[model samples]
Target: MGRNTRKRRMPLATKIVAGAAALTVGGGGLVWANFYASAHEDHSGHNRTRSAAAQVATIDCPDVGQKIRDVPDRARGEVDGELATMDSQITNAYQRLATTRRAQAGDAQFVQNSILGPLKDRRKAIIDRIQLEINRAGGKADDNLDELAACQGRPADQMQNGDGQNGDGQMDDGQNQGGDGGDGNGVAGPVADDFVDINDVQPNTRDSRNGLAADGDGGSTGTFTTDCGVNENNLFNSDNLIAAPGVDNGAHHTHDYVGNQDNDAFSSDEDLANADTSCQNQGDKSTYYWPVLRLQDGTQEFDANDQGGGAEGNIGKILKPAEAQIRFVGSRQGDVVAMPKFLRIITGDAKSFTNGDANANTSWSCSGFEDRQVTDKYPLCPDGSQVLRTVNFQSCWDGQNIDSANHRDHMAFVQEDGSCANGFQAVPQLQIRLAYDIPTPTVENGQVQNPYAVDSFPEQLHKPITDHNDFINVMDEDLMNEVVDCINRGEDCQ
Candidate 1:
């Protein structure tokens, strides 16, 4: 249960072969008994089969959080609580989907009828409450909010894998595994096809260093580094203060936390400001956190039976990072301004699996192969090259609010030419570079061994594309000014 403490156990990957079954519509439901393939090794060593029978991989629901905007300040708390409830509902439904393979195989419509249908009804009630809260507070909720309540079961093969394409040429929807969720793999996701050999990936035209940044004639080139121990105290939580401030287990996944020590679902700005700092410099009390990475080797973690861990399909041994490098860089366009105290920013989309990759901001590569970063797949680093996860936060601030209704409108990414959009100002950008010493997974006979994945919402199926980062600025005024000044002066500082 402690740091680096894992019970050594190799989980066996048992192969399940599909048997003959009929696919038909019976009594207002579709039945495809015994046709769904079980988890097995294929000739190509990829975790998928070319069988014509369709298999339910994961559930896809409209992201209610992203669609609900213009929430009044007075109703924000209630809206956020209901949204967190929605996340929990999705997690529960996914857990059922993962454990009910026999039912899913016996009846193709079991997932839609027993899981997704009830889920939509619950979500409709939640959305109605959200609308009522907003309307009660003098804000108009969207008329189409009910449309977001229904969810559908997507076939495993239709999901985007490392290749970023599926059979129908639909954009990646994160899933790439076959069969019902879990598919006897123990963990729910990150099958062999989800990973790609780093050597096979073509070099991306966009430089890995500034994937989110742009070229500019005049820009601040300086950098500021902050030494924050990589969760040395093992601070972990399943809550996201920015997204679901008052809801416990808000994230539905474990997160490795470093920096302000008092962060939780109930922590307020004052609590965070007064909290102890994990950073080497006491002046910087900002909290940085992201989903914990886990190895699918059958080692149960401290939260193995807990709601956000094994119970939510995020089972495995948690991997502590070898290095956590937190740095602040200047805007690519010009001198940067100091970030406001208590600013909350979330980069990347945690629900990108079903919501699409429009806000997906993942960067995975090996330490030596940093030049070739891939967003859709986890990199299988060669020996001695540690796995790396780099994240770049948005640097364009709207100049007024530290937070927004959806927690995004107040900040934006820089444009192609490195300039902020009209009315937005350049601010120091935060970049997190995390390195892990994980064993390279093997794909022998289509069976993935020792696979690793980031913890994600249960329905997200532990896809690498769902990797995201969270931040809350609690730096003191003077220290923040120093950071801005150092970047503006084109001088590196610690």
Candidate 2:
């Protein structure tokens, strides 16, 4: 009976169809809701992801930019620091060299006093060593800086290449490729080369004749002679010889006159005794000698007696001869003689003479004489007394020709009568000449060749001993400026 009620029911097929339709509607609704929900949620998550990625990219960009910007500054700082260090090292080397030079100068003084022999070789060695050290320091600094620069990004050709297909093609892996080049780890090159060689230096010496004078007593007359060759003998010999009692005899014997009666009256027995004693001691040796003459009333006269022999015993011998004669003699031993106060004179070779040339043969007219006289050619001495005596032609010309020439080259002396004594205090002067080989590019056999050639004197410097103290000040300023520059540039000074 229930069945009959559902029955008014349509056909079984219709009921089934209605159920199916309802189920289809329900499933479609569920699918639509789920899709809508999912779409909204997906949008939020995507937005967050995009924002995070953007933030990361922005952060990375600034870091990279800052690093790039800092590279140069850091490099500059390092360069400056290296430069400062190099400067200090160079300055120290210079100081050491200067100190050594000063010490050598002191040694020279000792040698002058006969306390030591010449230290020419030692001084030269010291100077050479200092030069070597300076060179080494400069070279090392250059090499180190060169290597640093190469590491920093020099030689652009050495950079690596990434594939074009990749998005990261332009990116660098931050690896250095270049090796040490010329510039130090971004540091500047070494300081300039400035030094003087010792071989070019010159020293001063003197000769005198006043030391050979005889004792001022009528009892005996001492005499000695030098054979400085015919030219020198004629230049210094006297025309008239004087003799007095015992003094005249001694004077005659000293003058090397075997026979002459005019001046023998003034000869003295003491002079003859002294002369004989000198001859006996020398085993009766006889030699030719040149007499030193004095000018009185425009007449040449011999005062001290000198023998014609080059015997060493003749140097301080007293003679009392009863005769006087004028004779010319030639003896090589007389070329160089030394007495208590006098020294023999000889003509030096024109080419060999470091002091004078052949143009002025009268350079030795005065013995042991020092005077300063002003001439149109040479300047007056510093004391304005007489013309300064210069050995070299250039020295004689001095300010007139070479205004830059050293004043010390022309010596100042005190003139007592015709004798010279007491030399003026001299100031130390140094001249430095620098020469080196320069490489040049040339084409040989159709090929480019770099070859070195000796360059002309490239530089010259003059320094006074007093300037040594200023080096410290110069070095300090240099160091401070370098450090300040590095700091301001934001360079890596280390």
Candidate 3:
């Protein structure tokens, strides 16, 4: 058969699903993603620009070799040395290729034949060495490097073209797989090479103070006030916070619990009703949750790989604000009106990690400093400062529904002019400003632990700025009454 006829004669299933990925939900709402993309260079034996070459099909190569600890101590040094050399080689080669692409002057074919081709070969070689190291450490190495090493460290089936999807510098969808960025994985990798070398990160700036301070020296928090303080009872650490309110392990990510510390996947309205609160009033049992913003308290870097899975939906770290301001604007209005109890709400996009950029609602700044902002990756704050994350949520409510199908329909942000958007009805605006004292990793009892790290879901590595939060109001009837009275009267209450 002719080549075109032969291609058309391929398997029916493969032909039906071929292209970039789009998620599908089954009857049970379980996510089913169909991803089909070429995993290797197109080789139609035609001497043309690789970009114009006809595309081919390939299977995904799942990752391997993260079980670095399994490598025996004796083999570790050799393995480390080999991997380090590979890192340097690939990074340097890509650096040059990227420079060529930018200049738009180098012969693309020449660069590919001379530089890119060799770099890809080096990448192939890395798989064997990585597997050897893993096996030497008494761990099993994946039999195939297609998913792990394909595209030279980029995730197996991600969109490559500069469709503005990931920061991966690939031009459109059908170009060289090794786009720019560190190792082409959207990660800067562990500060392995830069450790002890650089003294500061880019866009570093000084911080200001919260206007909500009792002294009122800084930004304004409006009328919102709380008795919740920092402590084990008010603020607890939990790794598995159920995603949906009543479903266990639903979140698949870790979160810091503030206020009602007894919260978990199975926590019910009654459970919260009877639970003791860390709020000073003792009657304010509201529960607040957000992905933990771990501080780098030690020398080691805590990564998404350690305990959390590295899958895309599993969750990664690093969520930041899309803009450069902090806002606390509106709430419901009326006399003697009370918020619907047990209301559930979530703000900020949860898919920021996979989307490759934080939504505008997400914001970040260095602790003690407010002039700078960071996204895409965690900011390496100055030596003694901490990473401060400020995430704001919607304040306006539908005034009738406690929650919606998506849990957010009942709540909304203020209007562009700072007026309540959902309706004239108002409620308290909720926002959380987290302060992280990022410390270097330290050795505890001879075991090294990463101090500045977050706990999220598994499956895909996460950056720090993908910060998320959850809240459930368990306010007493009296306190809710007081809040309603104060807001209706247009008086700020602490």
Candidate 4:
């Protein structure tokens, strides 16, 4: 496929709230709504006779990893293991909560006592161990880490539910009144309100202040493209070597990988360096992977019964991308430098649903309507326009480390002026554009038909805000220098 070298930056919005309804009829045919109400909303003098008590839509836990900024290299292995344990704990808790709805209806405190309370204890111990590891390695652990152990049940009203027709033709009251066919794991999210017609979105201007700056007159405006074929090899896995190394099912969601062939929970830097490449240019052996998009048409995929697949609330037939365009572009401030070997960069957050949009760097839009992008809602593209997922990796390196305790401090995005911050170096920014030809999903009667969603943690409920991408620089030193030189000289090369 031909490549588009034009600069198409993916702008992460401050916050995008897609409207969705979470209505369920529990045992005894009692109608309940998953109303995620505002924190300060008053329920005084309100009539509650007709409605069953509001139910907890999902679990909300503090992202402990995002909070931990410093950990001794010696203790990183222990810390990462503990973090992965926390994730599994959440998953198990969510699974229990999802499967025990009938018992929950009988006892109001079932969720709090049996689920949240026990989960808190488990997480607290995990946090304590994480602290001990840091302290043992001569690094001070954050005292507030223990405070993040408590998790709360998110009320359904907090989720943005649009006023639309319910299954019975009743207008949605922003509360739970309609039924949605969730991924069949009690995590019914990305409902009708989660998808908006692309034509309905207004054309938006690129917010240069929040995105990669456009090429300027004196800057290195050249580009280098690498033809990494779409992952036709079916190289799928649920492991995230960068985030949760040495742990199986670290991601807890399936990912489609291209470029590097040997990527999993156990791959070391040397393993990746020696792996074969899918890129046309054999010199580019870097790994690029992201959560696979699935059409919720009820087709049983290979992982339908597996840990990170249907069993964990990630369902539907996986769709392979038609185009995987990996390109390296010059910085707008000055000449770019070579990215260090084995440098890891993760753009966007996979837990932005409960964690908030502070780290969310998603750009979901239609192929033809790339300018009208969204960070939360999935775009319902027209027949010919394909769904597009584009991300721009951090273009500034801290100059000292290729990896960090949180995997983020080592890399940084360029400032609004297109210059690296003090003590950071400018490097060729990696922009990955993924395109998929998915059938447009239909939303009617507040029910989505053939809904498509990206794989996410069960607690995330398949939110688009949870979309993210990962990359690891494994390019040989010679090729890396050539990439930098090509960009600095303002010449487009392949």
Query: Please, what is the whole-model Cα lDDT of each candidate in the order they appear?
Result: 0.73, 0.18, 0.41, 0.74
* Tens digits of per-residue lDDT for model 1, 406-478: 9988889988778888789988989999999999987654546678899998778778889999999999999
Write down the TM-score of every candidate.
0.84, 0.13, 0.49, 0.85
Candidate order by lDDT, highest to lowest? Answer: 4, 1, 3, 2
Provide the RMSD of all predictions against the true structure, rounded to 1 decimal.
9.1, 46.3, 19.7, 8.8
Q: Which of the two candidates, 2 or 4, achieves a greater lDDT against the reference?
A: 4
Q: Would you list the clashing residue pairs of candidate 1?
A: 45-446
Candidate 2: deviation at residue 261, Å? Answer: 32
Pick out the ten consecutive residues of candidate 2 with the lowest summed lDDT: 463-472
Tens digit of per-residue lDDT, candidate 2, span 399-472: 12111111122222212321223432211110111111122223233222221111000000000100100000
lDDT of 3 by residue, 62-112 (tens): 222222333554554445444434433432443233223322222435454
At residue 3, what lDDT does model 4 achieve?
Answer: 13
User: What's the ranking of the predictions by TM-score, best on top?
Assistant: 4, 1, 3, 2
* Poorest 10 consecutive residues by lDDT, candidate 4: 12-21
User: How far does residue 470 in candidate 4 sit from its true spot (Å)?
Assistant: 0.3
Comparing 2 and 3 by TM-score, which wins? 3
The deviation in Å at residue 348 for candidate 2 is 4.6
